[model samples]
Target: MAATLQLNTTKWSLNSNQSDVLIKARHSIIAYISGSLNKFKGSIDMQNNEVEDACIEFNLDVKNQESTLKNIDSPLYINDYLDSNTFPNITFKSTSFQKISSNINFLKGNLTVNNITKTVELDAQLINITIQNGTKTAIFEISGLIKRNDFDLVANAYNHTNGISLGQDITLTANLEFVI
Candidate 1:
């Protein structure tokens, strides 16, 4: 069956404009500050504008996660942090999406990382649905905040010299392009 999107279905992908994944301490010795990995790969399972019954999932390559001081791809497999060898990928599955205000929607889902699963709620706005070049594409902007410690990312290296944080708060912004 062909895709039932608002436009001609073609290729779709996920992109992020700004993502701040940081870990800091009270004394202000920052452990790490990552701008964006830009290595996230995922798909949207759209059955039209209704995402209520849809199953959306994403897999983030841990090895590609970068920081202000370095590229910690290899370190992701280490014992202190992500431990990508055992976990491999960070993932999320949407449970539901709800329309609240006229231009606001809430996406509720479970995010799994480092063998820990946590519920995350994201606020999103459907930017526009436009048809161009015989293809219909839907653009959306999403934002959210999460605690790294909640996902067991407990490397507090900035705190105790071996510890990485007072707490790590991750702020994310994503731009998704989809074909209907």
Candidate 2:
């Protein structure tokens, strides 16, 4: 008699304390400014220990961002740029998650920001997976580029001649940890 292996779907929750979500954009056409989104929640559904048919959903608190730019008070102000007062959340729901290689995957989803929804594709890399104390944990790094103008994330009354013009392209990177 041959033994058959049973594969079941598992749901994983994001460990926000062990994760980091960052955004980088060009500042004044020379320097760059970076910021971190501190509060977020997400989940992943995996079957047979693979990401080929995984479903990912994430939500970020726009009002909880922290900037890394120094000497400036309220760098990338929430109301000035993101208008967090109107839209307090940035959300993503994956339509498909395809594995390209053993560690590389492509994630296509609808990203909603500032009340605008757009389809975006991001690169996902499996960093590591570990089993500790009968718990399964997985770490992944997700990254991609998005345009600020596409989502109306630009400030209307900003002075451009003062060497403070923000760039259109914004790079987003998230190091996410999930536990099952």
Candidate 3:
């Protein structure tokens, strides 16, 4: 039997320097672009190196996103996009976990954006877990896909002429580091 690593604390937080959430989508008829949420916060609970019965929450600051494409970055703060002034935060809260292995799991959660909430599943990987200097840290790689239309983010809906047609599918990935 494999040894279970006990949780040093029931609470953990995201290390900003080591954690980030990135999103990718088709920019036009021929290219894909990527952007990242510059600010976010997370909290989770675990008892045995597994988030078996805890709610994992991540709150993202949508106003501070960064992307190389100016056309894509500028509209993200307006009413048709994220509406940063109104819906400044995008969030996710885990409801359950489907364990595939000791290091792999599918987290089912509610992802909320633009005041709309939808159920989404995140493929999660336990990249590393270690204890050093009397502190415990865990790193996770998570990815998922969602439709921007579902959240009413249709800023580029009719802008094909500008060579900017944002795709409906948005792929989100994150390397989250949690410490306790």
Q: Pick the candidate with the highest TM-score.
A: 2
Candidate 2 has a TM-score of: 0.70
Residue lDDT tens for model 2, 108-131? 889888999999999987777799
lDDT for model 1, please: 0.54
lDDT of all predictions, in order shown? 0.54, 0.68, 0.65
Q: Which segments of candidate 3 are over 4 A away from where they belong?
A: 1-17, 28-54, 64-86, 131-134, 155-161
Mind giving the per-residue lDDT tens digits that candidate 1 earns over 120-169?
99886767767889966766655676676787665455543353343355
Span of 10 residues, lowest total lDDT, candidate 3? 28-37
User: How many backbone clashes are present in model 2?
Assistant: 0
TM-score of each: 0.57, 0.70, 0.66
Q: Which pairs in model 2 have colliding backbones?
A: none
Per-residue C-alpha lDDT of model 3 across residues 1-180, encoded as one tens digit per residue: 999975464677767556766655655422112224344456666656776533466677655446332334433323334555678777887788787777678988899988899999989877888898997898877788878878877646654334445667767777788888
* Model 3 TM-score on a 0 to 1 scale: 0.66
